[model samples]
Target: MRGDGARAWLDEGLKLLAEQGAPAVTLERLCERMGMSKGAFYHHFGSMPKFRTRLLAHFEAEYTTAIIDAVEGAGGLTARERLERVVAEAVKDTGPGLEIAMRAWAKQDPEAAAVQERVDATRIGYLRGLCEEAGHATPSRMATLLYLALIGGAHLMPPLPPAEMREMYGVLLPLLD
Candidate 1:
């Protein structure tokens, strides 16, 4: 269990992630931002890699839980509809820039990559369950394609009107049917 100070450090670290890209987040930067010395930094995390790993783990847990909850709350809804809702909520919740930062950090950090893999696996599993529930065939392939489309599309999506965000769901939702 982490004490208040440690949790504070983690909170500040995540805030930095939200404010700036991952590359710009450094131990020195955190120290300066938190108004702490090197000792305080090392007290919470032994090294930069360790801190980065924890940060990714923290983000993964929070994000995956949100996705799962969104899907689960769509009880009795069609799989496609549940998935579309998840995509929309995920985008609004995570914001475009933070999602990009996560992808960028995951690309460069093994620990972050591991968290990404776990999150992806969980998403794929959720889609598989949805397919099963809907009596759809080829759950694995469908899950893979669904995740790829949504995640990849979210990354590359250009600026859109608020209406377009919800409207895009209508366009893509049919593919799952």
Candidate 2:
């Protein structure tokens, strides 16, 4: 009841970004989608730039940091096990539209670019650590390959389905061994 209005804006705005890309996340479009008003948007975010920053932050936290935390914080898990957890999270998250859109936005917006760079570095670093822990000889290369596969899958026209993604990633399991 309290922050529900702002939360609605965030959730709906995320959907808009995923389905329609960052350009489609304007105040007019988000309000149109939510059947709300500028007053309400301002009530929650105070300004569009503030809202965009919040939206990007939410995406990074939810899609990146949260997954990393879940996998790494699970305790007693091996490097391969941590990767398996990431795969599982991939299937359960909101698919790849947001990922693709964020990456594309990074090409045009400095703020998004900064966030994207951090995310890329953080993820690849995480994967490299996992590979090293698993005794992979070329951890950085292996990690980059793994990350590239995930991003490539996002760029697919219809986007790859979750089961297919899992299967695709499964093919790399042998490399870990």
Which ten residues in a row are the worst by lDDT in model 1?
157-166
Clashing pairs in 1: none
lDDT of each: 0.71, 0.86
Off by over 4 Å in 2: 1-5
The whole-model C-alpha lDDT of candidate 2 against the native structure comes to 0.86
lDDT of 2 by residue, 1-177 (tens): 122577688888888898999988999888788887789889999999999999888878877898899887899998899988887787665788888889899999999999999999999999899999999999999999988988888788878888888898899867988
The alpha-carbon deviation from the true structure for residue 18 of candidate 2, after best TM-score superposition, in angstroms, is 0.6
Candidate 1 global CA lDDT score: 0.71
In terms of TM-score, the best-performing candidate is 2
RMSD for all candidates, in order, please: 3.9, 2.1
Q: What lDDT score goes with residue 92 in model 2?
A: 61
* Candidate 2 TM-score, true structure as reference: 0.91
